[model samples]
Target chain A: MTQVSDAPAKTRAQISQKTLRTDRWWEQPAIVATLLTIWVTYATVHVFIGKWYWVPQYHYLTPFYSPCVSGECVPGAASLGTWFGHLPPIIPYAVVSLPFVLGFRLSCYYYRRAYYRAFWRAPAACAVREPHQKYTGETRFPLIMQNLHRYFFYMVILISILNTYDVIQAFHGKTGGIGFGLGTLIMLVNVVLLWCYSLSCHSCRHITGGRLKHFSKHPVRYWIWNRISWLNARHMQLAWTTLGTLMLTDLYIWLVAAHVFSDFRFYN
Target chain B: MSYKAALRVWRGDHGRGDLADYAVEVNEGEVVLDVLHRLQATQAGDLAIRWNCKAGKCGSCSMEINGRPRLACMTRMSTFTEDEVLTITPLRTFPVIRDLVTDVSFNYAKARQIPSFTPDPSVGLGEFRMQQADVERSQEFRKCIECYLCQNTCHVIRDHAENENAFAGPRFLMRVAELEMHPADTADRRDIAQDDFGLGFCNITKCCTEVCPEHIKITDNALIPLKERVAGRRYDPLVWLGSKIARRPRSTGTPKVPDNRH
Candidate 1:
């Protein structure tokens, strides 16, 4: 090993500085914005479609309509009792609980990084200036609502459980006998993916265990936290896929309800 | 076997230059810095590369090895195949003083921008006592050796020179995190962090974490948690109500504005 004295303390001129990347920096932010815009538009319009979120024949309720807490929910479609009475005109049962789910995503550390850059253009890319001059961060007003992410995480967990219940209920055929179909399999995939997205949250990881002083004292928690760390590494990937699977699950259910095609039943 | 490897080294100053090719002799278990030292010793006597503590601790030898910000002393040459030509360059975010050495005054400027720890005077100087657990949280961030690699790889300033005025990059944000985590520090830095230090500029990309030789969880443990703290206190309605209650004097019992008008 060379002696530390070998390292010279030569300070060169503070000449011009910048990256040599000739590639346009705007490309990344552009792609992120485009994808987010498409997803948001689809979700917004899909949620308010006010129909086709469930198929009683399969007992499969698309995630967006779960707990279908509206007086207007189709008979037998309301998984939980309607609190606000049947759906009020145009406002779907999903909208009531939608705020909590949306709040979870909005406050998500991962999604916050995404939309803040893509939509808000807060330094849209590395080394680029933000469109706006001021930044109070989440410390101010609505942005501060991000702190409510943990509370929203709890609601999402309950909703995920409800969706799981819906999937189990799918096992019961339309006539109330045990059955299986392709829709059941699709719904299964959707709920599992949603679990991955919800459970991999940093808040979840922290709750399972973080800020610990002694690992040996609480071996079980340490073990669980170790597993969560692995999932957290792929949180973004899982989050993105859950979005796709969710839309697919809903679309499949919608098609079944529309009689576009009958669900392929394997058992009855 | 002593084999010769092609090294495409960037050989110029801030104004201009291109990758200059060289055939350097390879030996067993040698890092990139060793090869550069040999290159300077036997061939390019004046070839400039900044380094200290060939053992990767000092962090004085940050450079772009194949376009990634890494310590020259730590990047093992064996990581590359014999036929592969290793491309060496200075960190892209800062101005180059010479080959493989960048002007890191930008980091020093940021360090100055952060307020130093302000202890509560009641505890008296050097009398402050922090619990073992309290100090451990901050110990994680104190590992920084000021390699500035995190600063360089941070995209916030790497591409946008315009962002230099606003963004403090990851290294300094972790610095602020360390201080704010201190049990004895009396200052409220939430405003300084988000508003002035550009804490909001970081989008938790983990680029800085990836390049940190210290392996600090810069994005997760530091930046994200800091954002939570700033938002948590303000967003909690209970805290809001508590603040409102604490504002009026408890001695007054009832809320009343004392008459000062004469």
Candidate 2:
């Protein structure tokens, strides 16, 4: 509410006007379609291969549970071989991720801002006026699926531990070679996806001390954490990471559930 | 103690601008804005200055001194050396109309979009209860003076104008965050904030907090918490399931930069 008064006003000095480029060329339908096509296709393929082959082949842990031979598996499971014969724990993973993915997708505070910048005003400058874009329901379903992040974070950690335990169980047997199971593989991939998501969160970036003026000295021996916070200084990086990884994790799980290739097994 | 200082003031509007020099005599306890008024009364009777509640409470009298955003009324004239000249200009973010005044209607327009408070019918006024901590969180945001200094200093909207379409700026974001965090508030403006108002453009630079007159942690306490909630909702799978079970359709409204996003 700045105000001006009249009384023999001071002489005016003119500022030079520059021709501004005012169009959001990136958000055009053709571009949007191309980008989305590449993104979804890449995500679908990665999830399929990672869950089915890569995780099971490389990581000792698999998504499937093994049966109890001598109280090796959970109670009531018959043998070490029987427990490794079930579907990946989809219910637990989905249940844990529900709140995080759904809550944020419903709220949508961050995505709106991110897309506005990433799409419409990619190279942000001073004073470029553009009409607001009418937000159709395109990004909703996956955004609704975003609530899975926190729960995914929680589940992935738990599942990773479970997979670790499965690895230990494999060694206890005579073969000593960790056999791959589908469930252990899914859990392992879940952990990786969750890591990509959590490390990119806006909150986690701050805890890492992004752009903070200074840090305190008292927390002893954990100085390493403080140093890493410095690397997490770029706010936009965290914003993008948190955004992309959350969406990717959901895509991963959905693909696993869909069984796109069908051999992407979660159990023996 | 008596003091002497030179004031370099921007004395015109969008049509013209200049730094006019003036000498001022004041006591150690006086404020810079007070000195400007005095100089206006004696040396330059035609000079116009806008201010209210010379106390920092009203948020008026926001001006820049030596290239830094400040409340003229809150700045101590004693901080500058007697030989030094203080350069004063209206806040840079807004358009100057004549002198130290500019059209700030843009902020008002943004404020109008926020959804008003809507309490759930189940929690009647009489039975409503919340722990003291929840109430305290909202109290922190109540300190804003609307001086627009935070708005002025924000690089996203001030230095980077392209962000105006999506970014609601810091002041507005803090206000919305406040309301959203209110224990009794049932309105979920986060969707609106995301889709329309542009809360995500902030990037958490903390420059807004650095220049805030009242020292409210606009980024840390307010914006960041709201971001967490928004991010949580966007990604939390449990809430998604709950919405499905409860049959609550996802809201599709544009987020408005509410009067206060605290």
Candidate 3:
């Protein structure tokens, strides 16, 4: 073993000087105004004009269900419209995106590090910075937005099922009884993929699993519980996946809305 | 793509220190610590690095990568873009030695200061049984790997160094809460938690939970509950009245908060 020495020695008071300079540039009125405007405009447009069609309309290229008569099979026909019944609606999209956007803006990693730089450690750069200012009542208005995760989980599950229906509808495209479109299938795939990603989130898992202190020792039930716990263990993966899929879901819809990608073909 | 990464090694000891930069070539899978080790082995043999397991299981490899408190082994080189310069430094809560290693003895000292578990042996082994629910409550706390990421990320300690003497931080509060909730362990750490451990300092920002590599809910589970217990003593009118009434000349209420610091 290499000889370890107490070469570095300092009193607690002495180490306090290692504080570093942080930036509050984002808090500047101009920057705040610009960010608010962009966010507000995006929300307003997505809510009123876009009509949440970006997620539902472009979902067209997935195979969900096939009518199989034992060894024999027939394709089932179901359009995206039949599955979703109607568009997801713009008001709900705006209501949902509003908090998510604000949550990301008001309190996030960037602003956190920014505050750590500006306030906690000041006038010098240190390896360990001081704790940023405690956001006392901040947990109320913006942080309460986190509570929306429960509702978001429901949306994710619903959208996923709706998308799964679309995928199944693709496989059963037997006749013109609302046969599946590739666009709707893609949207369906998008929802299912994102739903798998979202449902397995840490917040969701904790909301469900973490609250449970005891369960009857039934091997069958315990097995299912353990599976959920296992999913919770990989919550970070789910977090990243949900983030990615949400973007993809929006992009697929946007391109179709803009007529950038005119046709989305399922079979190569 | 190969990018020129800066290896800012702390050359001098505590008083005299400077961020000396060494340009090094980095690959996709190589981590910040990997780059540092390469620098130490080839470029600066005398460079000081406190690392045991590169797998991130041991907390020995904790350092600030580009001004973020992350386990060096877990940090991938790919996280940084080509044009970015990565600043590597020792943990802030502890004092730095030569380079990336800091004095983590503070954690050990704090741990020692907290009263250890004393099982009520009179109850006898197998005599005491608790519901699976109560046991499970503390089980989540026992999962703490003691990475001190919670300690490091805790604003009470990370920002206000003075709180170190009084406050136990989020990590140890979880310890106190674990002990307090234990069925067999018959010691009261509430007062000590309030005064000495500085449980009130934690504003429940959950920065500790967020930055935790182990992802323990130090704020939600441990610290908040401990604070509530302390508040029960200090403010809860009903509990305060009960404690006051139970104060017979012979009957001492809960054990006085134990002296934690040696």
Where is model 1 more than 4 Å wrong at Cα? A1-51, A67-72, A80-93, A112-158, A161-173, A177-196, A203-234, A244-248, A251-268, B1-4, B14-19, B81-85, B118-136, B183-187, B234-238, B245-262
Off by over 4 Å in 2: A1-268, B122-127, B235-262
Clashing pairs in 1: A70-A86, A71-A85, A71-A86, A72-A86, A72-A87, A126-B155, A127-B155, A127-B156, A127-B160
Weakest ten-residue segment in model 2 chain A by summed lDDT = A1-10
Estimate, for each residue in B1-262, the C-alpha lDDT of model 3 and write its tens digit. 6777865555665635667788888877888778888888778899888888887777788766665567888789888776666766666666666666677777776677666876776888778666675577688888776667777766555665645666666777888888876766766676777666666555455567766777666665666555545544454455556766875232223444444344
Candidate 1 chain A, run of 10 with poorest lDDT: A1-10
Candidate 3 DockQ, CA atoms: 0.11
Sort the predicted structures by DockQ, highest score first: 1, 3, 2
User: How high is the CA lDDT of each candidate model?
Assistant: 0.74, 0.54, 0.54
TM-score of chain B in each prediction: 0.90, 0.88, 0.87
Docking quality level of the chain pair in candidate 1: incorrect
| Residue-level lDDT tens digits of model 2 in A1-268 | 1111221112222222221222343354344445445655754444234232212322332232221222223332232233233334332212232343434322333444444444544223222222344332222464344333344445444544553454444332123354434434444445554444444444454334331211232233224334543433343354445435434444543444455533243233
Would you list the rank order by lDDT, best first? 1, 2, 3
Instruction: Choose the strongest candidate by DockQ.
Output: 1
Top lDDT: which candidate number?
Answer: 1
Candidate 3 C-alpha error for residue A229, in Å: 15
